[model samples]
Target chain A: MKKVTQILSLMMAIFFLVSSMGNAQSKNKVRKMEYNSKYNYEVATIAVGVDGTKLVKVWGYGPKPEEAIRHAKELAIACAIFRGFPPASNGAAAKTPPIVTDDSVIEKYAEFFDNFFAPGGKYLQYVNLSTDAPPTGEDRVKVNKKTYKVGVVLSIAFDELRKDLEKEGIARRLDAGF
Target chain B: MKTLVNFIFIIALALNSFGQAKKPTIMVVPSDRLCISKGFSQTFDNQGTQETLPDYKKALQNDGDLRLVISKMSGMMADRGFPLKDLEQELKNLAQEAAESNMMTSSSSGSAISESPIDILKRTAKADIIMDLDFEIKRQGPNKYIVFTLNGLDAYTSKNVASASGAGQPSSAATPEILLEEAVLSYMDEFNGRLMTHFQDMFTNGREVKVMIKTFANAGISLEDDYDISGNTDMLSMHIEDWMANNTQGGRFNLSDGTANFMRFEQVRIATEIERNGKMRAQDTRMFVNELSKYLRTNCQIESKVYLRGLGEAWLIVGEK
Candidate 1:
């Protein structure tokens, strides 16, 4: 009877462990986009990155690394143009990614970006500038079989800190002896 | 039942067809003179010696402070709304390339020599932001007066707004703290509010607007004979926040309320690359202006004024540079 009890307890522990792992993966679904398409074809790569920290999307795909990079750049630029630089129009979500372009690589590109920025990866991407750049700690993410890299997304949210930005004379760089 | 099902389907489709607003990111470029030294030899020399420019550093620190201050400026022009996920990867990739170049791995994939914002600044040399600044102190009796010259401020399409590359001296006699404060304050007054709009037109519209102011610091200009003190003299005369703003700076102007449906005049800067031999050497001042214009262009409407001392007036950006 004692031996039977021990085996039952062991089975319970394994079941719990498996359940926890499943929960963890589910939580990470948003970070690492699950393939939404009907098919999971043989893909050479499926990397991901954030959309300027404004929009969290996945983006990456190619038969090779260069092709993946090209697809990623194309996706990133589409996002950039959608935001439209400096944002003349107000009431717009500052950190949200612009409308994802409906292109051939949209799905893979968005996924790559989302994974690149989620959770960790700050140390690898941004320059310190020694200014008020947001905290980009030693966060890392691995994609395309490459070692983990910084995934921190820094967006200077000036609206919240408008008073501070103006008082610092940020525009003085244009003049003499600046 | 059929109608309700169709309505629900339409609602779902509508929700999917929306754009999530986003803030853009802007990487600022420092002044031109501070970017690189004159000629390749000077660049090689100063870079070889790592002595920090305490004054320039101070100014940069001040700009950092100002960035905080401007974050408070309301309406459209605020913090640079950036798309981080997309940009971070691009920057990371670029950073990787840069690291590879520094390592001198010529065979490395994506081995292009990545330019730091500073490198970009130097390559484009000219812009509204002056790179290097110089000063000459002349002791007159009990008071020591300093003459400061700004270099690398490019003029616009017309020759009216002159570049301050060689020198445009503005004299002053104030304490160090006061000198720095006054220099920033006074200059800002000359270029804030609607003035930003006016400035943007010059830069993006093809017309340029450049101004140089020289002020004296508390201790006066110290160590005047430094070889590394030459400023980057070619900077843009104006600022353009929009692509369509690029127009030729010339011809008719009603001058009514200092604005018109379309207007053009001089008082501008030009953006021209300066290169000698097959190797490139210099860039015009518009580079910095271009950077600044990015901030403003994102806005739908801009409202501001130019203030000199206590006097202020509303203005607008229009026409070509």
Candidate 2:
């Protein structure tokens, strides 16, 4: 009976330790993926909204469809601020220059951006899914056994975003005369 | 305590003055290619050469599409806080001035002075930047689309400062104007960004302008004439160069060409404003040349006449007004 109790206590300790370790590992993975998605993603201007917004299609990767979709929003805003859309063939789409022209600005304003792009953070205010339905099979693809890639169309209030950046002293205002 | 208050007040005044900096005035015009392609150009004799120029008056009167396009672009720019000089309004003003001038002929010769439409526009508008627009509508079966291009050219230098071009999505029911509006909306931000960057660069490097120094045929003085100032004797041209070096922002300017009677300074970067009477005043090529004229009068005992061609080029003819 004593041996069984000791074994049961050891098993409980082991279970708790394993669960906490798994949680730490998952947290680390999320941080790493966030950093990767911030720098690496594909974004294209799908359409422009009449009310000073931009509809961009961005591809984001994660371990699940829901996670990928969340990353897609973050990537969409990041691309709009840093990597602008390329000119399309036959003049199909206009070339949009990035809001932040300086390449080193991300690193310089890392703290501000980190807080801005955090989960359920200020970046959510600028962007939303273009459609009411969730992404379908084609839009959500399994890139590997452990990773899923999702394409999302997000409408970003680009002008408002630019104004906010200018207000935050990250970007210069067009009317800020010499 | 009174002295400290005065010091604080002076600091506040200076800060307030700095906030009143000027912005470049913008005017929208049809591109030369658009005018020529749309049969809105006229042939003119220029010093024995046949030259073609855009007939802006004809274009404005005949083309409804052009009017809509210009209105859309100007409205968009105005919304962005840029000051715009309306082309159509300026044209009317020109016509009124022409009629008035025709009635008031010269009393001695009974002849009236005439100016070309382009010249009148330039003199009246004096825009620092010209936004040249070009566009074409394309059709694919029942669907219609528009391809558009906008070029921001420096009015003074005629250099392309910013440009945006693209095609709008094909639509079955959208008008050409709507298609153009869509295309411009997508590209205007980038184009405006480039424009603002260029303007900010002017703040750092100064505004680019041209200056030419000439001597009157009967005037005894030449650019090569030596002038003595503060125990330093130098040619008038050298003195002018030294003044330009001292007064120009960052001492930036180019002596593109020089002769005994003619000296042309291209890429003369002049300050946008200067301090006078303990206050800041706006400056242009005219104001800049006026300063040079004053300098010559005060230091070299030389009288000069300043002639300005629009806002960018100035001629300082020594020994005569």
Candidate 3:
């Protein structure tokens, strides 16, 4: 009986260890998926301002409209830095080049980006809602029963954002003199 | 140790300032094809053969739209801190110079020297890179759009260093200028990025130029002549190649063609600057070839006359001064 109890305890310990390791690996995979999804959708420029600002429409997906709308702001900033707007049919999209071309920069400066993109972080200072309220009608869509796809138009202070990145050593300055 | 540290710090500061001081000068011009298609070209007799060339003076003076476009592009580049040599302004300067030259004649021969308009512009501007712009406006029913192309070419070699092209979205009431501005805004950054890369490469690997070597008809020496260098017999051409290998940046150069009397060294990577007398000085094709000419004269007892065409090409005529 004693031997059986000892064996049972040992088996329980092994099971917990294995399960925790599996959970950690799956968590990393989920994090990677989330990061990639932020850049997967297309961002289009609605209007370009002469004062170094760009009004861009970005799409975000979440379980709720409010969550998706919030996520769209983050996506707007991310697309500005990483993935520039793609050309759309009938000249709908203004195919602006991204401020930073190297994608590996995210992984290289992971800590910096993580903090810069945190909730209510420095990225917020560069982008704002072009309109007073969240977009409705065609801009917001219910994808299936569990998810909402929301498109938000945000005004991004592109030049200021680029200067900030340069200050932070994340992007090269134009006048740095090659 | 303390004095050495101070000396090192000063040196670092000077080097940093030197790196920041140099930026490529750029000029924007309408592409030759665009000028021709828009009927802004004129024919001129070149050695008895009539050749059509872009008449930049006429284009700049007659086309208000072209002037506006050039100004817009120049403004954009200026915003990025690039020094721009305005094409229209340069053309006017050339015209003024031509008028001044035409008023004067040689006292002995009663003749005046003439240069082609393009040559005069090249000598006057000396732009490191030329931005060639071409655009077309297309209409679809009631909507109009613009497809534009921008190419950055090396002023000396005419090599395409950077290029960007795309079509803008159609609009019902957008003017050609608006469409062009929108189209270029998307790709300008990438184009400038490429231009920067090329300029940086020039600093690292050296500025590329072309060198040609020729022997005068009456010269007794030829490139095939054998030279005794430290008991090793090598041809005169071999000796010249060795010098090029030693002097050029990373020994980077191509001997494209060689014969008994002629040698062509294309893509010769020469240093942009060199340290002399404990000071860094700017270098060019003339200075680079002058060093080679000196080497030939001092070591091989050969005299050569170096004739430079523009800033990137040099011809060394052997056996003569």
lDDT of 2 by residue, B1-321 (tens): 999999999988886766444566788888888888889999989999999989888888898888887876777677667757888788788778767866877889988777667555555645778888888888999999887888998876778999887677888888777777777777787788788778777777888888999999987888988989888999999999999999988899999899989998988998877777777766778889999999999999999999877567788999987
Candidate 1, after superposition: displacement of residue B200 in Å?
A: 5.6
Candidate DockQ scores, in order: 0.01, 0.42, 0.32
Clashing pairs in 3: A91-B169
Candidate 1: give the TM-score of chain A: 0.32
**How big a share of the true inter-chain contacts is recovered in candidate 2?**
0.63
For candidate 1, what is the TM-score? 0.23
Please give the range of 10 consecutive residues that has the lowest summed lDDT in model 3 chain A.
A86-95
The list of candidate 3 runs beyond 4 A from truth reads A1-32, A35-42, A45-49, A61-64, A92-95, A101-115, A137-149, A167-170, B1-10, B19-22, B45-50, B98-126, B216-220
TM-score of candidate 2 against the unseen true structure:
0.81
Candidate 2 chain B, run of 10 with poorest lDDT? B118-127
lDDT of 1 at B123: 31
Measured with C-alpha atoms, the lDDT of residue B23 in candidate 2 is: 64
- For candidate 1 chain A, the 10 contiguous residues with the lowest summed lDDT are A40-49
lDDT of 1 by residue, B9-78 (tens): 9877644433111111222233344323321112224757854332322343444332332222211122
Give the best candidate by DockQ: 2
Q: Write the per-residue lDDT of candidate 3 for residues B1-321, one digit (tens) a residue.
A: 999999999999887655442355688888898888889999899999999999887888897767777877777777776757998888788778778877888889988776678555555545767898888888989989887788998776769998877777788887877776666665566577677667667766888888888998887889999987667689999999999999999999999999999999988998777665676666778778888899888888899998776567788889999
Off by over 4 Å in 1: A1-178, B1-97, B102-138, B144-174, B193-321
- For candidate 2, lDDT tens digit of each residue in A71-124? 889888888789776654445567777788777878889999999999999999
